[model samples]
Target chain A: MPETETFVSKIFIAGSIDAVWREITKTDEPQGAMFNNRMHTDGLALGGQIRMRTPDGKYTGVIGEILEFDPPHRFAHTFRFTHLEDAECVVSYDLKEVDGGVEFTLTSKGVAVGSKTAKQMKSGGGFICKTLKAIVEKGRLPLHVWTIYHVLKALSFMAPAATKSENWPLKGNGDAQPA
Target chain B: MKTDSFDSIFQALAHPARRRMLDIVKDTPGCNVNDVAAAFEMTRIGVMKHLAKLEEAGLIHSEKSGRDRRLYFNIVPIQLIYDRWTMEYSGWWAGRMVDIKYAIEAGTNPQEPDA
Candidate 1:
């Protein structure tokens, strides 16, 4: 069996801690920083369930339970992507107030080395942090991200009905919906 | 990202040994100082110094795991630098491309009345 590893990514966003936290925990709309994944959660509390779904509610990408929910500071969850066949990993977001802005950090553990999920997380971590920082600080996304978001929006109609939000409830059979 | 942070990041990455140390830590997460030092012919203190520089640049962070300190690379500072360049230049080029595409279409069509 491959050994597990921990990955950490951090960013300095020129914004208040509250702004950074809001972007991370935003549930009402799609977060462009998260590749247009709209967070759907039962509530913002410990032990509640959360999932990242498409903007049109047509597909679900990630599903996990909240492990920590400290407001404006720390939020941790067991992240398991629906598309990858890997063990659930712990992902935590830590926001600290700095001199002129917030220092946002993302840490993940229990990722098997060289796994597909690990590869994705390694690359995804940087882009996510960068996009989140840009969104919180500049109020916009990079041009490539903007173009990808629109393309995903345009392709939403091709999503399968089985993957729609209505099919995946907050309390499901303790298994991820296959992508 | 601040100017000094870039200075530190680039400086830390300037040395071939430091960059190799970074790659080791990045490729092997949770690796310790000794694990990184073993790969080098330099003295342990020398490796420590390079690790310190990398840590100072926010390129790697360490946590005490029992008796050993585990090191993991942090990609945020580099990502910030990347976004800084791409966002400014890419946005400009994308806008220009759109304008040029429209110009080409308009010039070739000659069908629609001029606004």
Candidate 2:
């Protein structure tokens, strides 16, 4: 087997197992904010397909076959985005009860070792874990939402310019401050 | 999106020498290469290589004036990275809260009328 890197994040939500499972598997926008890209899926069952669109309107679809299904406890699936023909990763969600709430563990594996995607996923996993914890504890979206939106907007501007020039002033870490 | 940008940033910061250089500039802005080199035990040329990597990652900026080039830390890129990830996770949490609210309501009023 080839060496692969994995990213794991766990969140404890004040909810029941069934409710948490439903939120993770179902709930699409403009109904819920779980996935912004407007996922089109049949259901959370074996051999189900999942697809998501980029904020820029680009589409990446994946075939998600359930590998493990333990009601209200665990769900695992194999995912492959359309752009990554040679890459197929496994994402699993494990739920457990603790102190009148549920602990959700999200794990992604089979990412290419030492690859850029793996690094981003690792950083993203940490940030997501922290943000999820904050939301659950405070019971509200963060006030810095607009700051985040603008950051993404800036990236959209700089990404194309980066390909053109090596010394572009816009090129830097993803955490660039907005101009 | 060009995902490689994030990788290059991390890769540039992967080295301890580069990270230390960043920390120094962040603490004391407008420090020249010689000033940064004095803090490290490595030779001046060795430190320059690390600074070059950081400059490439856009973590630091340098400007030459007269005989010295002053280096300043740029923190905007790091901030952008933090914002994007935070928003996505926050969205997930909001969805989870909705499900929880419904579950709690349903559990409390099994006999009550559904509205």
Candidate 3:
């Protein structure tokens, strides 16, 4: 089998597996909280529909159907958007009970290596995992304080880039920062 | 949207050896093609071909002094990739949490539910 690329994010949730499972598999709740507002989904049965949208609407939404549903353990679904076109990918969550709580792993699979989707899926795993931890533990997520500073830097980078004397690339070691 | 530099950047970075070659050129700015390949115990011509690809990708440039060409890193294309890959995502990723702080601490009650 061709080894497909996957984006894996692991989070330790203090909540019980059932509670986390409810959060992941629950449907049709009032959609306004940090966890609830980001994604809206219909029934989560096999072939059920799901959609996730970024708050700013920059990425629009990824709409898809559930491909696997094993409550309190695994949930997976198809993921597609206007940006991704027809490249089919699956997003899955696997929950395992740990010492004090649950170890949650979110994975996005079937991404072709070196594609933009691959990059997004890779980085997105970190973002989503951190956001999930923040919401489950703290009741909501907050912008990483550093993110504000980086956003301005990013805008500057988009402009006519300066030469390397300015340390222009900013030289992050490709590790995901705390969210 | 793909840029012309995008493919070259990924292609140049596809191999661990090539990336190591770039690192060698980076530490020793005046390093020659043979110098990069020697670090990996590869043939000189083989390293020359690798450096050629790096040069093609705009990741490094060479200057001929006498008969030897000294290699120097040109990070513009790498910077472009960094801009596209990291900065672009950070913008929206931050936005995803814009209202989260307020949502959690919404009222006097600390244990308030997210409505």
Candidate 4:
């Protein structure tokens, strides 16, 4: 049976439209972190293709031509995750000026109903929105950054095992019996 | 291990309904299933499913009292996850910046001219 799901997320970023655009459309740099790849496209205009590349030169998605484009206001496009059949979806971004920033809404439609990808799209969408907000407001990576920090802290405490030498003295060496 | 934990947290948070539920609970304490369901266009069962996911993710907790199952926010785990993920990336960026600074001081372009 065919299933369908939709996810929407909104965030208020305290920055100008140009700044947001640069971050949103960046092909390289930290802004690419949210997409997990560099967006390789000429522009984000109507009928303009939005493509992204993996570090290994693999094509992740062949984003359809932009359906809508309004600078600092809105952008919409169709996305096809190349490796997954029936993984076609529409992504739209609506931006509005708020008291201290811009309120942006990201909507994804046509996700397969009850599929793992849909479930993930729902939650991951929100995280990405929040992460973008944090980035715009604080100029930082936010949640992913925090996750990495804690993991390193935990690993730092366990690095002793890797530094251990095979010839290291055993405890109570003087009293140790011959093997 | 950390990446797995991070992935789980992200997976749990991927849902829009679940995130909205978290915000509701965070703003108001002791909200029941019905109250949460009322906030959305989805059916009670739909909301309950979202709640179940939230509960499983440790983002929220629930208890029953007098035929009412009250859900409360548990934001600590989210904060912990955020701290873990954000810090790692930031550290990497910091190291790169340091390298860039050293390169500039040596009268060379810090970044590779072209990839």
Best by DockQ: 1
How do all models score by TM-score?
A: 0.80, 0.45, 0.45, 0.49
lDDT of 2 by residue, B1-115 (tens): 1121567678878998888889998666567898899999999999999898777665675657699986766554474466557676786887678777886877854344467
lDDT of 4 by residue, B15-52 (tens): 88788888997665467988888899999988888888
DockQ of each: 0.32, 0.02, 0.02, 0.02
- Scored against the true structure, residue A153 in model 1 reaches a CA lDDT of 81
DockQ of 3: 0.02
lDDT of 2 by residue, A93-155 (tens): 777787667766666778777665566555554454444444454544455643664565456
Candidate 4 vs. true structure, TM-score: 0.49
lDDT pick, better of 2 and 3: 3
Instruction: Evaluate candidate 3 and give its CAPRI docking class based on DockQ.
Output: incorrect
Report the alpha-carbon TM-score of model 2 versus the true structure.
0.45
Instruction: List where candidate 2 sits over 4 angstroms from the true fold.
Output: A30-35, A54-58, A61-63, A81-86, A135-137, A145-179, B1-115
Docking class of 1: acceptable
Residue range with the least summed lDDT across 10 consecutive positions in model 2 chain A: A168-177
Report per-prediction Cα RMSD to one decimal. Answer: 9.8, 21.9, 20.9, 22.0
Assess candidate 3 and give its TM-score to the true structure: 0.45
On TM-score, the candidate that comes out on top is 1
RMSD of 4: 22.0
